[model samples]
Target: MQILLVGAGLSGAVIGRKLAEAGHSCRIIDARSHIGGNCHTERDADTGVMMHVYGPHIFHTDDQEVWNYVNGFAEFLPFQNRVKSTTQGAVYSLPINLLTINQFFGKTMRPDEARDFIAGQADRTIEDPQNFEEQALRFVGRDLYEAFFKGYTEKQWGCAPTELPASILKRLPVRFNYDDNYFFHRFQGMPKDGYTPMIAAIMDHPNITVQLDTPYSADMTATVDHVFWSGPLDGFFGYDLGRLGYRTLDFERFTHDGDYQGCAVMNYGDRDVPWTRITEHKHFSPWEIHDGSVCYREYSRAAGPQDIPYYPIRLVKEKALLADYIARARATEGVTFVGRLGTYRYLDMDVTIREAMDTADAFLNCARRGTAPPAFVTSPD
Candidate 1:
């Protein structure tokens, strides 16, 4: 089968490789000049430091297969993501762990006492939490929520916590202990040479031909046996159901003589602060150091058509539009929509890879039995 894989991101590359390895011909196309979508990385021409083109992407995954698969291309270095935040006139550890609890309240409460104290702090009135602000107030109380999530989230999503869904807060941690690992993934590491080489290796299969600056259009469906689309689901149907909302990022890159922020990621949680976070790419790889340092101040904003979409804002109305697209995609033939953009979800790199692998396996099974592949391997909604 001559399969056309759209968007040369991790998801597209993974599925393309699997199908090609199984004796099928595959062609990978990307809108960008590079292979890796947002995960694209390259060495700085002037300083020789590894630069994350689309801001910083720290590959932290609990999935052993994801770790092993990525490692096959580039040896990964042991890296732990220790994020800090600047809010209310101070820098503090993230995830609101024990350290944050003690520092925030100016007390010396231990793990158990901190848990009890915070439980006491919860807003007793909010019995049924509806939005993010209410959920945070009910769970961790006002001071912590306002200090940590409220402002940062508002800046990131371009809306107050009350407008956002509670599911967003549910993803964050309010730990009783001092464990500050931002991610609970079983396997986590930075690629030895950065993400670009790894993704290039993934797409370097004999039967796969990658076309940079190439985008797969609906008209091409007539020639190809199947299309694996990793672009936005709404884009595939020309937004006939209306554009699903997405949150794009605005990065302001700067360079300095030495280190800037103490940690890799330091978020600004105060509502008065304009930017959400500042990322120092060098800190992602602690073992390496340079005389100068580079950083990006990332500000989240309402996505425009020209800006790169970082996350799908799966609000109520957007979810409804996504459902319509899913139905339209199901009715369409010879295409499977997979990955973050296709599904319109905030997918970590690991989940994207795992789902792509599964999607490819299912496609192969149906193809061998002379059956048509499903319009979508998974639902975007």
Candidate 2:
């Protein structure tokens, strides 16, 4: 089997590896000069600290299988993601935890009392929440929502909370305990080296040939036996149904002598504040010692024609457009769409890898059975 993988991101790299191991000849191509997509990391020339070229991607997952798979490539150091929010002109912890609630209200309340208090603050009248605003009001009340989430959400999504879906707010952790571990994942850590080297190792295979400057297209539509596209789903069809909405980031880089923000990630929760968050790359891998630190103030905006697509804003309107692409992709032959862009969803690094693994497994199975692989491994709709 001859496979041509577009977009040399984690999805493309992982799937390419699997296919090559399964005795397929795969050639992975990426539009960017380098591979690893958004997860690309490199050592800072000035400080020598590992830098996230796109944004901060902390590897945290509950799946032992995913953890083990990544560990096979690079050693991971135990790291807990402790996030802070700068809002109402003050610093506070996130996830509405006990310490955060007590600090915000200037009261020393117990766990049960804080939980009950927050519940009381929530909008009891909202029997059925519609948008992000109403959902947050129903879950954590107006005060917390406004101070911590409202402005940040607006900036991040480029829309008012009322215009967004409630499901997003549901994934956010809201805890009564004092615990401040940002994610509920069982395994939480940073790659000992960096993501770039790890991904490079993955792409270094006998049968896999990576073409960095080349982009996949209809020109070779008949050349390869199958195409594993990890680029934007809309990009694949040339946005015939209209461009899928995406929120892209703008990073304002700065170098400070020591401890710029004093944290890995700081959420700026004021509409007045332009940037959504500031990430101190040094803190991401605290195992590394550096005298000076580099930081990125992240600004989110609607993705432009040339901007790198980050988060998929799959709203109702975009969902309808995606449905058209889905239909078109299904009708198309010899293509298996995988990864964040293919599925048109915002996914963590681990989820992206897991999906690619599943895709390769299923595709291989179908091939062995002399059948066609499905248009998608995961569907947003």
State each model's CA lDDT, in order: 0.86, 0.89
> Which candidate wins on TM-score?
2
Off by over 4 Å in 1: none
lDDT (Cα, tens digit) per residue for candidate 1, span 1-381: 899999999998999999999999998998889889999999877666788889888787777887788888888998888889999998888778999999999999988999899989889798878998988899988888888888888898888889988777664357778899987777788988899899889988899999988766767878788898899888988877778888888889888888887788999988887888899888887889787888898888888877788888888888777778888988988888899988888888888888998899999999889898887777665
Q: How close is candidate 2 to the true structure, as a TM-score?
A: 0.98
Name the 10 consecutive residues with the lowest summed lDDT in model 2. Answer: 167-176
Can you write out model 2's per-residue Cα lDDT over 110-156, one digit (the tens) per residue? Answer: 98998888888889999888888988999888898899989998899
Clashes of each: 4, 0
Q: Which ranges in model 2 have alpha carbons more than 4 Å from their true place?
A: 171-173
User: What are the models' TM-scores?
Assistant: 0.97, 0.98
**Listing every candidate in turn, what is its Cα RMSD in Å to the true structure after a full C-alpha superposition?**
1.2, 1.1
